[model samples]
Target chain A: MEQWRFIDFGLVDIRDMMAMDEAILKGDGDNTFFFWTPKKSIILGFFQKAEVELDLSKCKDYTITRRISGGGIAFSDDRCRQINYGVVGTIDNDLFPLDIIESYKQVCGVLIDTLVHYGLNAAFRPINDVTVDNKKISGNAQTRWEGKLLQNGTLLLDFDIEEMLRIANIPKEKFLDKKIASIREGLTWLDRELGEQRDMEEVRNVMKKKFEERFHVRLKTGTLSSNEKELTKNFLPKYYSPEWVYR
Target chain B: MEILKTKPGIHKARGGLIRSFVFVENGILKDITISGDFFLFPEEAIFKILENLKGTPVKREELLKNIEDTYAKEKIQSPGTAPSDFTESIMKALEA
Candidate 1:
């Protein structure tokens, strides 16, 4: 059995997460787990052309980054939101094209167990979403490299519909409803559902325990190698540039 | 050249804010243009690649293969439009 390491990084740049993905894909790092916050950012999908998914004029006030993984655009902030990344070795090629659905289910299982531990209702939704009472609480994305998989997702600890609506190009009609009924129908947050507050640190601890129990693996803490740091330095500028962010 | 305009089906709610226009001349791809407000990394590089592919033919597999390669190298983030979607949209437009 191979050993897996879990690292808790309180807050990090979205670019660094992406650079780590690239490094792992290039076979530079061992299978690892990463959890962090993006200091208020919107990360767009790899293939999603920027102009269509975002309102540049509105996003001008905030920083934007493009993720190497495939998924729709997502908004991130300091408020109760936690983003987690898992870099694991490939399981089997027979499940080629990668069983994205199964992978999501495995991760969501840990999340659901954690939510249940807190006495909150959470369930996995098809395609790639984890929701509470049909309202999305998390969105996940995955990418493969050199027989390894990098799966990452966002857990909404709180609600930020105002900022989400502003950055994303939601229909005007949906925005007019002051109640945000439509948006509310699609999204749910821990703060809203539990009527309490929780930060990334708390979320991380609960998640860590759940993951260890569910996967039946011991997670050891570790740091990036010198090679990874060098790669991150080179990748950061490119990721931060308008070319990568707005492209 | 036939200029085909169609809603990028993936994102239809925002008045088809994601637009893909492929310029085909007699079944051959003269040029391809993917324009919209969607967030894509290295935005300018998308157009540059499209411009470079101007003279290429409209073979579906070839188009997808080339685009994927160019995207990896340029690190253009917009999954933009898939080749199958591109081919279907263009075929629909040409027929119209």
Candidate 2:
């Protein structure tokens, strides 16, 4: 069986979470699932130019940066409301399918099943998303670096709609164009769906069991090695730098 | 010569939104940057799309044909929007 290390991290800087993934991909770490409820923050896609996607003034209230992978911009506020997930491993990982689309489908498939277990009618949306009633509850991004693949996404246990809007969901910038209400239309939250907030730990435990079953792997509790910790420190500056985030 | 700028158009396709911005000089696409909330596999493929458009005549049909041919040969998969959708955005920019 493919043995995947599972690490549940406490709230950390979003950049450190991203940097740890990079450190893992570089072989300083193992194939693992890194879980963290990030501090209130916004991390843009690698290719996303902040000017077009985010409002600068709004970002001052949050920790803003970018990830190495590409996808839509994401934000998180309270830890209780968001559970961020990352799948980090080499391309040879048995958990990942060979085809890019299939890889996305596989990961999102497990996500759908996991959400379904929560009594949420979740379905996998093509490319990289999970939805309920056609509204996204999870959005994902992936990167294949040489022989390594790292897929990171968010799970919205609960999301503050107003906070999301005030932060400039570009398409939902109502002040600029109320008619372009696509973001809100497409997004949803677990709390909103269930009409009650479930304990975050209870949801996380269930999710861990679901992941273990989906990949047919044993998830042993694991954390950063000293080497990986040092590497994350080295990688932090890039994620924090304006040049890299703006690039 | 005046620097040309295409008004950004956000096309909501199946997969997601594909936003297009076109820059033209003398009826040729001097530069173009297509970005969006859309997901593009390989991510780097985006730069290649932008690169292929460089120096191309800024005609709707021509730009559409270029991207369509490239997307087909490259086996490009954009879930929501099609290559034609991209050309349509460029066409709007051309009109403006």
TM-scores, each model vs. reference: 0.73, 0.86
Q: Write the per-residue lDDT of candidate 1 for residues A177-241, one digit (tens) a residue.
A: 32455775778877788888876677778888787777666778887777877877777787778
How does residue A187 of candidate 1 score in lDDT? 84
Error of 2 at A216 (Å): 1.3
lDDT of 2 by residue, A1-247 (tens): 7788999987888888788878877666777887888898888886566766776778787888888776788888764578788887666535686666678777777678878987888887777888887788998988877677788888898887787677664653221222434656667888888889889888888788888888888899988888988888899899888888865
Model 2 clash pairs are: B13-B80, B14-B80, B15-B80
Give me the overall lDDT of model 1: 0.63
lDDT of 1 at A125: 73
Give the worst 10-residue stretch by lDDT in candidate 2 chain A. Answer: A172-181
Error of 1 at A93 (Å): 7.2
- DockQ-based CAPRI category assigned to the predicted complex of candidate 2: acceptable
lDDT (0-100) at residue A190 of candidate 2? Answer: 89
Put down candidate 1 lDDT per residue, B50-84, tens digits, no spaces. 76667666665666666666777886543334434
